[model samples]
Target: MGRNTRKRRTPLATKIVAGAAALAVGGGGLVWANFYASAHEDHGGHNRTRSAGAQVATIDCPDVGQKIRDVPDRARGEVDGELASMDSQITDAYQRLATTRRAQAGDARFVENSILGPLKERRKALIDRIQLEINRAGGKADDNLDELAGCQGRPADQQQDGDGQDGGGGQDDGQNGGGQDDGQNGDGQNQDDNGNGVAGPVADDFIDINDVQPNSRNSRNGLAADGDGGSTGTFSTDCGVNENNLFNSDNLIAAPGVDNGAHHTHDYVGNQDNDAFSSDEDLANADTSCQNQGDKSTYYWPVLRLQDGTQEFDANDQGGGAEGNIGKILKPAQAELKFVGSQQGDVVAMPKFLRIITGDAKSFTNGDANANTSWSCSGFEDRQVTDKYPLCPEGSQVLRTTNFQSCWDGQNIDSANHRDHMAFVQEDGSCPEGFQAVPQLQVRLAYDIPTPTVENGQVRNPYAVDSFPEQLHKPITDHNDFINVMDENLMNEVVDCINRGEDCQ
Candidate 1:
């Protein structure tokens, strides 16, 4: 979310900080031993050990966004700014790791002493500041926030095998795909990074859609299975697939007022005026791309790009090639936004300015607890994968689907973590005790991307979603954001149409 000039909160000052893991030497030996002992013990109590000489791939930090859930309204803006800064710190550190290969090889403690150590200290300072803000606002901060400041160096092939839990670069039962490869390109120019010597979207990241087993998912909404009862109706909105080329790297929800907070570009639809500085009133007064003038909501997600060495506009910019997100941006061929009723009963009208984020953008490191991925081919929509990128056969197109949380807390339009205010349906397909079901927003994005080639375990001309440099462009990190700005009359009309079991646009 970009903004014009204003005396705003401090922004992240770009500075290169080393990030990677290498053999501990000199002053880093004790720290490495401690890290090794703790990393094996602390990740959700799942003890998995890596070999002593296993290559440390990337920095794995505990996501503070999920913590500090009790921030007060008065302190939220400041805390959010600090959280955004933390992300930038990691990005800069990763840049150093990705670019300085010779330094890491020559000095055994280069990564630990120069990269991981400083990162921990900086994160600790930010965490302390968050605690102070919460306490000042009469909110109870999490007692163990200090413990989250430290991060571990994850191995390249590490997988979270035991317990099928999220957290730490574990492949949770196919939730985050298979083991990560060395992210080499078919051309074999750069061996460690992606084909472009940037971050990732390794050769193993993609799988043919035909190879995935069919019928792995059961119908959740009842309308798909022709079942009786439930609202069983739908309302579609005709927002173009960002044909106007509105793009940015700001996250208005998580990092409002911070530029390039997303560290990668996003494609926007519906609202024409959206950025980190967009207030509710600003959005209400802005123009919209929706055919219906009454609906001025905002919808956005990471943009997909083809890794064919094409330099887009942001090639030399902060959130583009400079940060390892290099390639030609791919426009979606189709973007469908639909509202559906719940399986249990009819849904009520959503309040205006309601915000919802459907997936986790940092799922690569933070785990799959918030991952909401749905990748498949146009013809093979029945077979969806959460982690692996789908390689559609000839004549078929790639598709990405997102189902927003339907159950609202009925109190707040937003939450501190941007997630607690909404909830997904339970196993029995009903809303929770104190929640009410609302129209679920299902977004389907289709792309007419050319199938990539793989030879000798290296991909060529691959397509991947833009992501945080440390996220490695993994598919599980895909996410979407929405803010409902529909007029009251239109909102009521949508609810009415759903209750009446009719489809309307």
Candidate 2:
């Protein structure tokens, strides 16, 4: 069943401690090693080696555990320095291992000397350091040795902070039956965290091109609406790598509060510090990582994976493969922000923290409802067609494009059901009757996932984001969500651009 769980958070004080196996799996030493015994002679007729090994219960070393639990303010810096260095080393080794594995998939001991051996010695020294700390804290160093040794040889991805899960956003393990999240997500008026009512009913009875003009697939990328019902102008912004502003997952649709992020994982970009516990004040006060010096909004969505059920993240086991687009994750190339449905004048400003969901996150991966998904060659739209996974032309990158509904009932920033506040625009780029029109937000992302094999010129391995919840393991899970965090200044810039009917890029 699709049960919602509140997000759990680790406090600031304890976050400084390094996780276990923070620096293992270097070089050829990653060959799985099972704990064994060097001495069999027992004076008491009972095996000390085997008995000691079974006591390994803690995930981290004993001293490190204490530091992790109660890191004092005065000694926090020293502990942080050690953990930061260890994490850096682990991350670097994992990247190199990934790269080398790409080329040396068959070479078993190729990296044995350079990376693994040194990491082994380094771990020994770290254990010694931990022992010293334990003695200073008046704890038993001898009793922790066996458990500490067992913590060695772990791969780097296990070193990730927090839960050590995928992207630190937590993975959704195919919660609902049939391994699908197709429960109308917002069905039963349960989509959102707020008490608001469900937005308008889900527009069932699927329509095609002639049936509806602008839909999940088309009529986006415009400047303003003309009297003749055509669209003109274009506006866009590129948001690059946002390493700071983030949250792995949150259940709250709009409000940023602690312990309420969704059970599944997501990647957040733009405004730094936009986590589960963040408030509107936290967002407004935070700086942005975008190039658009003025805008400070957070854009997020579920992460995508390749058909082979692999994504280039050091989530579960790091250093598995290296380089070569081994399932590289994708992000928006540009955010196409436009206002539609208005024949004249500027569009009204959207409420801050307004929530939006675009494309059916639960749509089947192929040729249905225009698939509500698009795949194309970079800078090439001619190859974009529904149900067909066409090959990209030489010198072009493959891309996916998606559109969000643009009409609002104007009474709420959100609804109980996740969809009511937003309505799809018409094929003519106009809002539907009775629903007020807002900016038509569109996002097109580029990906470098595994390409299909051509045996006798026939393409294979064609896939799409499969379904919701368990997105990392499926394709055709092409759904995305967003929250409006732009302050008044940037909001007005959007308003002015739409009002002048000039497409500003």
Q: Which candidate is the best by lDDT?
A: 1
1-505 per-residue lDDT for model 2 (tens digits): 0111223354322232222232122211122111101122333546533222211111121123222333333333343344334433443443343234322223334345444555545555665665555456654455444343222222211222332111121111111111111112211112110111101001110111122222223323223467643333345655663343243445345223423223234556666656655666776777776667566666666544332323333222221111111122344444443333355323677778787766443232111231244546565654443323434545565666666666777866665335666776666555677777666666666655445543321223433332221111122334566667776777777766766666774
Q: Which one wins on TM-score?
A: 1
Model 2 sits at a Cα RMSD from the real structure of 19.7
Worst 10 residues of 2 by lDDT: 193-202
- Pull out the clashing pairs in model 1: 1-250, 160-170
lDDT (C-alpha, whole model) for all candidates: 0.73, 0.40
Which ranges of candidate 1 are over 4 A from the true structure?
Answer: 1-54, 161-194, 217-226
What lDDT is reached at residue 209 by model 1? 84
> Against the hidden reference, what TM-scores do the models get?
0.85, 0.49
Return the TM-score for candidate 1, rounded to 2 decimals.
Answer: 0.85
Q: lDDT score, residue 470, model 2?
A: 15
Local error of candidate 2 at residue 219 (angstroms):
6.0
